[model samples]
Target: MKSDDVAKKLRRLQGQIAGIIKMYDEDRSCLEIIQQVAAARSALSSVGRDILTGEACKCASVKPGEDFDKILKSLLELT
Candidate 1:
């Protein structure tokens, strides 16, 4: 995905975190809190996957002699 899409996802995750904190402060039900946390985690994982996919696509487009090993290493470390 594009940088703008990633930024939007990050902002949404940030809002989710804030909501989680508020729920905690309000002593919301454990189930509700857990559900929100799971949603946030899923969102973060999606973002990570998107980033890795984008990086991989970029690496694939490079010429044969280009240094993609670094990108490969970074993607592996991220996973």
Candidate 2:
């Protein structure tokens, strides 16, 4: 994904995080806080998936040759 896309997604996530924090300060119900936590986790997971996919795509464009094994190992390590 492009930097702009990543930035936009992160900005939205940041807002969500801020909202969660605000809720905590206000002593919101445990269920409400937990709901926010789940949403934040889901958002972060999506961003991570996008990042991994982008990295894989970039790596695929390279001529691997002898380094193919090393690249594969590194990619595996990432997961």
Candidate 3:
């Protein structure tokens, strides 16, 4: 994803976090709060996955026979 897209996602994640905090403060149903938390986590995971994939794709164009360690490191770091 582009940096702008990533920034937007992070901003949205911030909003979700703020909402979760507000719900907790208001003593909202635990299930509702948990659901929101899960949504936020999923969004974060998506952003992370996209960033890692983007990086991998960039390094993937290395010339044939070039060192493969960089690509391996990128995938390894993802885990």
Give TM per candidate: 0.76, 0.75, 0.75
Question: In lDDT terms, which candidate is top?
Answer: 1
Cα lDDT tens digits, model 1, 28-78, are: 999999999999998998898788877687769775344675766667577
**Model 1, C-alpha of 67: deviation from truth (Å):** 17
Rank by lDDT, descending?
1, 2, 3
Relative to the true structure, how large is the alpha-carbon lDDT of every model?
Answer: 0.86, 0.82, 0.82
Query: What is the lDDT for 66 in model 2?
Result: 62
> How accurate locally is residue 55 in candidate 3, as Cα lDDT from 0 to 100?
70
Give a tens-digit lDDT track for model 3, residues 1-79.
6889888999999999999999999999999999999999989888887777667667776753446666656565764
> What's the lDDT for residue 63 in model 3?
53
TM-score for candidate 1, please give it: 0.76
